[model samples]
Target: MRSKIYNAPCERESVRLLRFAAATAALSALAVLAPATASALPAEKKPSPSVVDVHDSELTDKQIRDFWTPERVKEALRNPAKAPATRAARSRTATSPSPSPDLAASAPARGFAADAARSGANTAAGLSVSQEVPAGAGNNIVGKLIYVSPTGELTHCSAASIVSANKNTIWTAGHCVHEGDGSGEAGWSKYVMYYPGYSRGADPVGEWTAARLHAPTAWTQDGDAYEADIAAVVLNPRLDGNLEDVVGYAFGYLFTENRTDYAGAAVMGYPAEGYQRSDLDGERLMYCAGDTTDAFPLNPFDDRIKLDCDMGRGVSGGAFVWGPQNDPRIVGAASHVALDDAGQRVSDDLFSSEHGSYAAALINTVNNEG
Candidate 1:
């Protein structure tokens, strides 16, 4: 798994890879171990008025595409934890220095994207069996996300396409776009590279690049804020056309708090464990379908959904879908892994931040600007 802190001066250790048993997997892995509820936000409130908007990368579309070659992507998958992009969690009271007047004065207004209509009826109630996406697949909107961190190390995660007026908005865990390091030390990710329907080291519809990032202040300020872990990325269209025109599918999502208990969903990602267990080198997409439960005590809040899926590392930013994996709407995006009683990172029972005002605002920001 990626280290919880990014760019820290620490040696990395090898984490064992774990995969879900196709027939034996069940929803019994849900466990809420931690109980620090002090920072939990009320679920009914709107997103915070202030958000962190970042578009500071210097790499252009061509530069990013050229930098992240197939060889680099393979190397990153081989050593998944070598250089995690996660930011270390600091005390909640830690504060960041203010931006210069030029930056603060020119910041855009806080925005919101109307929750798109939910698509496809909720169906099935079982664990999501791990499946590999095929090459040349049509209507596939979910795929691998690759990028270079500020330290210049190649990093990656999973992301899903979302329906938007711009038709270029994508969603994933906040840490996927920005290092989750506590305030001041963190910033937007650089050299953003995305490959939708990437299977077996192949870019099915070619790669896309990120133009901007919209994330909740909670995550930007506190790396441990799992409830606020989701982020929305606006992409620069490909040379051929817009993202939707190429993939031909983008999902809608729900922002209300009512979708938590729904069991008809699938959490999909390009799990590194799958690569370790086989010869694919983490290039295949895997998912675990099941109902979402409260990750409360362990997560210390209601903002995250707990599932029994056993995905690892590279899957951090994968989507939690409400219907079919290909053309489904989303309710959450996977963020962090839970720790066992022994304080060891556990692969099963992953948590995802639920879609809310923070997500809506991210979508809006991208639509208005991207």
Candidate 2:
């Protein structure tokens, strides 16, 4: 087993440990997203994230306290440092063209912003993919998860379905369930679980417990920590709702089917505030680009899966669908961040691939559980 580092909230002046995690790494993932500072800095300038003043609105300690009620305070206490350590270089399990060594050498290993610096921060593109509905009832898809510490604190992440209502499973990153390689798995984290379509932290349907949490064991064991950082939860109580019975299923892609033509795709799901991730389904539907690409050290060889979709804190596990055309389907998902040669961090994309068998396996797990 690898040594796990846990993060607390940002109760201090600086951004608390936003994982880029599970960046468990909003900040952690973005460590690589920002333009690299090492080479950019005057050789003598201290090599670190430049704290340029920005009109950024982070959660107030009071707000966090109120949002989480009692548990958040304890998490705040555990994470005392202004920042944790991010990898000097992003780590990747598979191969894309080798990144400019300049970018490779300076990736932040681990630190705050593990959520890759999130805030309803969303980016996406305009594309199209195929999706299907499971006929009848409510065939909607959604993401779900739980945050717990050894101290017994809890929170939640969100998710969405791309496969229409055919199955009762939801697709999301692995970290959403177990805290992935970096933080969520720390001893401080008790049990990490997910619930689909859970709004306001409550299950709109019957509150179903995870019969099983399925993900790439590699990510679970760090095979390609960030690459195969995907997972799915098998709902113990199958989805009783269907398309006709409910609203409708969100469109998405085929399992493990790669659609490189996804230049403009739509990503949707419940966000931090929960529910459709928007007050009016409009904001909830995030559209990104197919030409999305930057240099991220962690998962270097990305095959063009990047976007700029807006999602708040609660929107962790959502679907990166490929469009509003006829039937849009999911192509990729918001996994983590990447660093360029300059050490700038940016959001990344995660899709099914050679090392992505685990992702499909997870999907199977959900099918079996259902």
Candidate 3:
């Protein structure tokens, strides 16, 4: 199978698109663990699945925090063309089995009302396909994640703080944290930092650096499998407290959910391109809400869901949320854009791996080991 996979990341001028054949590999079975709850789980007692792979940034928190100066961040925003490109190996063709019914779980968000007070209204031009997240809507949980790629390019992707036992874990796409397991390309990102409530370079909630990054072996070891494109980051605490405490909210999780559960769901991020809108420069929060459809039914090995969204690069790793606007649960992270046979992006479609047992296992590993 041939496909053009563009994992979104924003930098200086052009979007990084990877093209490769598809490889057939079965999804690995994850060790069962109890579902997470709103309360923190016991760190020493919980057992996580072995399928999760952890990558330590290996830099001092200060080193990571001090690298992103105002000027450097401005450069990252201005260039828009220097983003690192990963030449992933052939895509994996694998069937991801459904998780046990008992694995379905969720946790509530915290600190939203307080953070909304600090958020400002969206100021970018609107597109017919997506609208700016309303001001003071408590969507501060979603933000931008900036990091230096192994190739030394400064880039950014959308991410969100999630309710976790440690209260410091955030969710994003696997490609946001590690280049795919392609020859001469597999590696972790560097100087990872997250800016919650980021708008046009404004850091309303301050910045948090990653203490550790986690992705499934299927993404880091096997070919860059779309079904395992989810990742998590454990953040170092700020001077005041954890990320969710400072941002005033973290999105809840909805694991083991299917495409049917995402009707009227919202996919949000900072998109630098899409809908042919010149005003979209990855500076503000945008969202497209609608029903979703199976992206690959004939393959059976790929269970990603696609939304009728026009969000493009920089939206990768953003949250796909369900439920009421006031209280949303994250079902998946933005993974990639489907491309036509001509090798151009299918602008109307955004894809995400359905969150299931692998996601739960990854989160549990981060909570216990990170």
Candidate 4:
């Protein structure tokens, strides 16, 4: 569970994003109570996992290969000018002063091959899991693992993967972004950033400045972080020139809305949680296999994609795609699921069309937005 609005300063603004939004709700709005929707999924007789629709007759089901990946998702960014309005949510991090940007420099080819190779190898050799993280990420109130404030405080700041052109880019679960004092606000901590492949205090791996941030507008304007539960971020100048190139952007889904055959799907992220994003138990590489249901009220609880992938507070805004690096076609993101019910926490798989846009429309946004 994550503390909503650890960052209190932006509480007022974040309230605007909430559902029954009021003037100054504390973490109550953004803070997630365990099982946001009290619908205990209740343990039922064991059943075989359902298969998702992988091949579409309308569109050729391209053989997802080893080259597909979350890093390469940025290829869609080619349409920088046409990206979606979703990018606007990032305004908080981008407009802030002092967090400062490096005078734009032509991207260098330094360490591209060496770094990408290392990242690939590391991922291939990383832990493996039998379960998957839930489908969403955000500020939960119960069982919180960490806490971060709008003032750059980091008792529990959510982590994101940086993938900016300057290499100053990162992705985090959405809760870390909108929970200004737990009101699901848009403003984030000023000095906030991420520690990639973060291990204990060592902060030994890569570090980048939070020059820009982007999450779905739902999270920023409507406090509906649960809906778009994904985010993109830009790094500081350090990414301009680095040893390891850092990871690339996550690819968009092959479809605009939801697709299926995702039972064996894979996802990866530096979930600041003690458990690995993959583990069926806590703390292991998480794997996913479940069904998505319709969206409901209370806790937005409905038939979204369901999964038993164990996740903690930090895994929000992470990517849930087809085989991750191997088959980078993004299928869904981590939405919340209720565990006490026994179905385990089921994750919803949101697609480009779920928001009623075509694949290219989303591509257009990624390419055009500033």
Candidate 5:
């Protein structure tokens, strides 16, 4: 396997490791959401996803921990940079066109900010109140992800743990792991790491590094295909056991055959905006709860399941859950923030590609491999 180096960032003042007492105190004030429900269309009988083994970060566990120090994490959280790596460069060739200005526009507006406020759901776009996950219910299901883009910039996104045979697979958006546009260093991300139960600056469940990645060919080939914008990653087990075992839980996925509507659903992510977030800095998991609707012709590139939640940029790979709260199934991931007619992202109008046979096959292949 080809390996990529995590280009180190400029050094800064060192921050101390997390304290258990502080974490416990913070957890006391966090509020968890109820069970998830959603409407969905049945999955089409398509062939398995054309899986592509993408880039490998190749960093050791200690290196990952050391690289993402509290200082760096604080910087990322306080002022999270938008998608800088994916901005297609301005090409000079006659046939090659310059990267569209819209591609580099700010993240879409938070999904359902207005409707949510009117309905008494939190205005920042999730659940009925503060977006923090309950103390223990979301320990393993959601976490903060850090990675180096192809051009070598440090950035973060949200990701989730999934039930896999190897017991070490994670699910996230395709753009989170690879340069979906197929440009950049080796066309893949480097030094990718996931920190479950990462609150404030503490990693309660330890860090999981990416050993291998699997993405749909459609994304790797061009990056514009939203329907095929999901990815699965196999992680190196830490301390002699897998991540799910360490955190005590993992989530399942769903692939219905016909389109369906949900009465209610929960969308969980690590967002840096839409709340009193100076403390958490994208460290604690937050959620938006509401019904889902179809927004088929909005983007033209993919048929998205429109939700009235206010999730924004940093939560790109967070899970959209349907079913019982304690044991919900993931039907899709927070893909791209849907863009409005003026080319700005619509935050309250969150969108996710319908997970189907292709996603199932991709996850199965990654877990079964080796």
Candidate 6:
């Protein structure tokens, strides 16, 4: 059945304030929005993801960590990185696209939280709109991903820790890690670091460096296919422990889920621009909650999920989640914010490729190999 798309109102102050306060103390402390049932479906076989070793050269993990001094991070924040863009369309009434026939009947949806719990879990144009997540108000799992782009530009994007066997996995957009298609070794980023629970210049859980980066071959070889824009990083263990352990929790994964399943979901990130609030500068976590639809006329065949969010640059790779508020599961990562003919972002639209076999395989490859 097709799900109806509904515009979520600007988050209410009372609700926003409560989440802000709780997110600051501990996101896990929040209650689950609903209970989830374990899926009885069998896992599907899919190809592994392409992996890149960030420490393959003389660059040791410590050096990579030291590379990002407070001064450098602040500088990177000043230049919020732009996500790869797509030609914008004017219609908002397009119908949802169908999942690929081969993947349509694949495994039932499944999720795994920080402690290994299961759970179930859009868009517009014009500078892209987003609500600022209060500084230090506590969703530490979601934070800024800072890296030196292939072009030597220090930039940032939103990323989150996810439940994994090594306890060191974080999810983000493929473009955040690689240059796309034929750009190759020169395209891979350097000195990738994640700051969970980051507030205005505060590193509540400290910094973690990436050991390896993984992206679907579809993304590395085929350019910016929305479905393949997802990417994962295997992080080196911090002095304290795994990332999730140090951060207190990690979001669960929701794979092979249908777009209609996300009737209500929350997308969180550190958006750098497009909002009127001066306080938002890509250092604070921001969020938008609403119903999602298919990418429709934008790319009718890919079946990307759509929402009415105006979050701009630096928000790419942000987490799109649904389920219990305390134990939310990630369904997809932010990929593209549609751009109009004049090269401006559509005011209220965002898109994420639907997570299916490819997504499951990407995460599995990183967990087992990276």
Please provide, for model 3 over 1-370, each residue's C-alpha lDDT reduced to its tens digit, 9 standing for 90 to 100: 2333465411001111221110000000001111223454433323245466787778889998789888777765553222223322224352223234234456654442212211111222122276677554255577888887766778888898888877788999887788755322347888898888788778777888998898876666553444567799999987899876666566767666343234556678888887455677889888876655566555444456666678777888888766432345677787766556675764677777656656777776766664
lDDT of 2 by residue, 1-370 (tens): 1111111100000111111101101111212232221111111111111110011112232332245434552352222111122221226552222211121011111111112344322232222121111121221244344544334445544455433123334555554554334432342222333333443334444333443455554444342432344455443333565321232343334333122333343444433221122342211222223432222324334332344443333334455543223333444455433334553332223222211223434443333332
- Give lDDT tens digits, candidate 5, residues 115-195: 111122222322423266666644555787787767667788777777666768788877777766655347677777888
lDDT of 6 by residue, 75-176 (tens): 888887754432122123322232233342222212223342223211211112466554432367788889998888898888887777677889888778
Worst window of 10 by summed lDDT in candidate 2: 7-16
Name the 10 consecutive residues with the lowest summed lDDT in model 6.
Answer: 9-18
Candidate that scores best on TM-score: 3
Q: List runs of model 5 lying over 4 Å from the truth.
A: 1-50, 78-130, 256-260, 275-281, 297-302, 340-343
- Of the two candidates 1 and 6, the one with more favorable lDDT, higher being better, is 6
> What's model 1's TM-score?
0.71
Poorest 10 consecutive residues by lDDT, candidate 3? 22-31
Error of 1 at 21 (Å): 22
TM-score of 4: 0.45
Clash count in backbone of candidate 3 = 11
- By lDDT, highest first, what's the ranking? 3, 6, 1, 5, 2, 4
Q: lDDT values of the candidates?
A: 0.54, 0.33, 0.62, 0.28, 0.53, 0.59
TM-score for each model = 0.71, 0.48, 0.78, 0.45, 0.69, 0.75
Residue 75's lDDT within candidate 5 is 57
lDDT tens string, model 4, 69-154? Answer: 33332221111111111321224443211111111111111111211211222222212222332322111111111223344334
Global lDDT of model 4:
0.28
TM-score rank order:
3, 6, 1, 5, 2, 4
Better of 3 and 6 by lDDT: 3
